[model samples]
Target: MSGEEYRIGLIHATMNSVQPILDAFQVHAPQVTLVNFMDESLIYELNETGIVTRNMARRLLNLVEKAVMGGVEGVLLTCSSFTPVVAEISHLFEIPVLSADLSMLEKAIDMGNRIGVIATVEAAGPTTKTLLETISSNKQKDVIIQTVIIPKAFHALQNGNRSKHDELIHQKVQELNRDCDVILFAQFSMVRALETLDFTTVPILTSPEISVKSIIAEITKRRIVI
Candidate 1:
């Protein structure tokens, strides 16, 4: 609420996540300033290994430390595959440190009993599933999680075939329609696929915009406390 613009540090594992989040901030919280730190190799390693090892989580923690030292009001990790690292390290920081999917997954649990998670990355599906289950358990809600992983769609996106990537995700969303009460795009990169399904009855959620709002709220709360 002050004239000073809030600065948020965005840590990314891939370039695909960068723009969608920037677009989200532009549309939802234009007054905030954003700084980005990207390590493309993180995504490559995760894709190759199909897991976030301790070394990878350590690298992400280092990035967040750097961002905090740079004086950001909050830190947002834009990759879904590494969301757990936020829970592990956020308490170490004075400012808000967030996982891109935390708010979206929590919201999904509140909105429905049957939640659908669609991800293009192999690591993202299980990461999201675990997060969804944890959030539901913490909230004391019973829910069913359906995760669909399409690695080929990520390959198509990497090859610059955006249309094919979106098409693949859209087809899977159609199949999950009858079974799910809400669907979530697990990665910021998957937000583009939302454009393809205009008539779906199931509620579809994406992380970037909602996550931006969550971080801003956290920043505001901290500011008030100070």
Candidate 2:
């Protein structure tokens, strides 16, 4: 077990999430091997319907199962919109299963009671807010959560205008910064906007780095040598 290179599965709903997690692994857990399972249709269908359908959940389950079959030691779901789906299926596997946003949110709750959630899509906002609320309740800490949804920026990025996407998100982050004690980017892809921001008084948390750290912590907690 000492020399083993653990393989972790990254399940994604969009290509936007892929690079952020890869970057995180490079910075934090370079020893582990990453396997990505992507289904762009999942995000497209969710946006079209403005809901997570039963079929989407099934597809996510299939992806997770496929990753397990492929010999992954852990599973990380990179889309914040599907975090709740991870909850339902994680118990089915013996390996560590995680939602990318969970560790970030937990850290956000610990950092401040006034948490601002920023998302580039309508689907991610409510899900992130819900997760923050749950974490706050379980911790018995009251929190005020505000969510800003910027779907136009998502469209801009989709159309290959990265500058426009970063501008829109940076502007909203500035506005949120004025009031929030801590801000959390609700999606892994949204973390890119931080590159454009010059400075902020409040702390901003992103999922990928925090998620990778949590994955390593989980592996250690289970006493797995890697």
Candidate 3:
């Protein structure tokens, strides 16, 4: 690390599939160090039900505060289920802490009126539903967000059958494509799998692309401010 080097902390409120998350930063943010923290805080609830409870949201914020203390220029949490948690943290921190989901969903807005959300956990599903409803309504636009849950396969990922996990996702997207105008993967771990998906006629939006950009922009913003 040097004077010009940027240090970033990525908080994963789950034991997130880390390979692609690291790879994305290496390519998109070579000068930045991507320090990571794991919080399987929502694992059971998410896998069983697909909704992020308020209690889980609190842990996510606590992690962001930890990242800030680590001297990171910015923090980005990779799970979509914690979007609100990210927002709540950013409001408290002086440094930038970004919502990976917020950046990714911005792309979904451009794709069309009907959004298809494919999620691995229970918490992400309900949080995404609320996010879509709030944003679409704020713009005076409407969207029909169709949600699909892959709890079994997500557990497979947790237990280490990554290949099986990816295959299940590909299978789910095939069906998801038939019903909505576009597709949005709800987790950062889903990106590597998503890149290989059939993609149908709809666009497949992964958070990493937007999230990496968001991180870079925020890091650069803080550098200028100081």
Candidate 4:
């Protein structure tokens, strides 16, 4: 099937992550139709609870189910903190289901032994760390992972201070570059910070582009027609 025949569903936990993913899709797969489902309250609730509860998982499942019922050819969850939940319900859906960070994590694991994750969201750091550990164990690869979270940057973005957010993340990236073999931006929302800085040394990875490509590849591989 071609890009024009696919309708991709995106579930966003926060509004900040949506634009970057949309921009990537436009450049990489413009013909595909985008179906966005956003619930900004999910971020607030996750921050309040400090973890993804059972009810939170069910809410994510409902969003994916709605996208499936709406005739979407694939569903992608744009929240790093909710990746495990997406994995849990992926078997229930006939269409392709993806977590925004899955492809990025795979790439990071393959790139080097020491991986650094820079994240704006508090919950994302631990979730990504857990994922990296699991993937490394399964692949029988000895990998070292380090995660740094800048809550201030996230709050700055939430308050509409894009420059401040970028500045904070850029500083963290520079610090991490010294020790890590590769750096991965843990949240889809954090990808915007890359525009402000030029880091030519360590390879910096982000979720949106990789996730977009992965979804497109899955659509083609399965020969799913929408």
Candidate 5:
């Protein structure tokens, strides 16, 4: 990248994950400009279907297309539930397309074979576990993944009770710490809960910071500057 500012587009499935990613960008890659496209309905729809429908895939593609047309150097899909779809069509775009959880998952796998995934949303737990398994398979590593979902935590977050949300997630993390080599927060929104708690048992991985760093690396690698 020359002297121009790099622009990155973020595709979010919910409003809950936006602020944490933005805050992470501000701290880690302050020079990069961020453009966010949020479709809160996508998460609800995916939760109901338990799979990515054709229409939902099309909507995600359209969002990426819009970001490319708007001159973004890279696109980050901040929804773990749609990672499979994003991975499928990522090659179609010339710009780098990254899943929010992949970077964190890689780190978790590298750290240990027994991984613990904690999610507030039911869909996120399975989706993230599958992604981790797939990635580990490709790397020729056999890993054991344990997933825990706290539906009420998500409900509390949606209702604006961040304290309750954090408390619930923190409790789960403490329980998983004894059994897991590393803990992965399955959703970007859940990463915020880490800020208020102190856990010394295992390394807790979150998506936003790791994903931001990955996107910045891609932008720098391609020398793409806005």
Candidate 6:
């Protein structure tokens, strides 16, 4: 917390949901602590169960407790899947707890015309899409949203083989560029792979950059004196 600014704890269910947000946040916050919850195994567990587990919920609380011990001012959960746990953790902590999806979904409602959400894991399909639709409906925005998946590329990242992951991302972007106006890199690990993706014409958005900005803006507007 050396920055003297408020610290926002980042809770990541997996590295796939951690890196990009942390990468973007480091530029904004020097005092942040990232709490990781899941391994690559959790992705498969999500696919198998069609819902998050009790252990997932427990780890989220553990991460927040650890963050508090480490002296975090607030917390941000990076996974769309484990937000149920995030909500519960928010009630325990005195400071703010944010879900990575909330702000961007707000933006999609406010400004996005045709939004493209791209996550690398196949299991992200139901949760991500459902969140988008729900947000759009709540905002009452005339938005068109399409969900995209790059499982092979994400799988490479999960295995810690970034070289292969970037390669797959390059090929995928070449095809996606034709369809999307803006691309949302939904996973945090995908941040490293951004420069590797070919987006000659379309602008790509990393969730960390946008989500962090939205959080900051809300803090400013509410003047939440952290």
Who wins the lDDT comparison? 1
Ranked candidates, highest TM-score first: 1, 4, 2, 5, 3, 6
TM-score of 1: 0.96
Instruction: Please give each candidate's TM-score.
Output: 0.96, 0.95, 0.88, 0.96, 0.94, 0.79
- State which candidate has the highest TM-score: 1
Find the 10 residues in a row with the least total lDDT in model 2: 1-10
Predicted structure 5, TM vs. truth: 0.94
For residues 1-226, write the lDDT of model 2, one tens digit per residue. Answer: 1234678899999999899899988878888999999999999898888778899999999999999999988899999999999889999999899998898888899999899988987889999999899999999999999999999999998898989999998888889988899988888888788877877658889999889888777866675454
Cα-based lDDT at residue 48, candidate 2: 89
Score residue 160 of candidate 2 by CA lDDT: 85
**Can you tell me which runs of candidate 6 are displaced by over 4 Å?**
1-3, 16-18, 31-41, 215-226
What's the C-alpha lDDT at position 39 in model 3? Answer: 83
* lDDT per residue as tens, model 1, 110-167: 9999999899999999999998999899999999999999999999999999999999
Where in model 4 is the C-alpha error above 4 Å? 1-4, 224-226
lDDT of 4 by residue, 42-133 (tens): 89999888799998888888889889999998999999999998778999988899999988998899999999998888889999999999
Can you write out model 3's per-residue Cα lDDT over 1-226, one digit (the tens) per residue?
1234778888876666466668777777677788887887566665555556677777777788788888887888877777877666587988888886886776687678889888887777778778878888777787888888787777788888888888998887888778888888888878767766555556888887678887787777777788
Model 3 ranges with Cα > 4 A deviation: 1-4, 45-55, 198-201
- For 96-134, candidate 5 gives per-residue lDDT tens digits of 999888888988989999999999887889989988888
Clashes of each: 0, 0, 6, 0, 1, 2
Model 5 residue 165 lDDT score: 98
Question: In order, what lDDT does every prediction score?
Answer: 0.92, 0.89, 0.77, 0.89, 0.88, 0.66
Kindly indicate the candidate among 3 and 6 with the higher lDDT.
3
TM-score, structure 4 vs. true: 0.96
Tell how far residue 156 is off in model 4, in angstroms: 0.2
Error of 4 at 148 (Å): 0.2
Pull out the clashing pairs in model 5.
Answer: 1-223
lDDT of 6 by residue, 77-172 (tens): 777666556656677766666777666666655555677777676656566677778877776766666776777786687788998988776666
Task: State in Å the error of residue 65, model 3.
Answer: 2.2
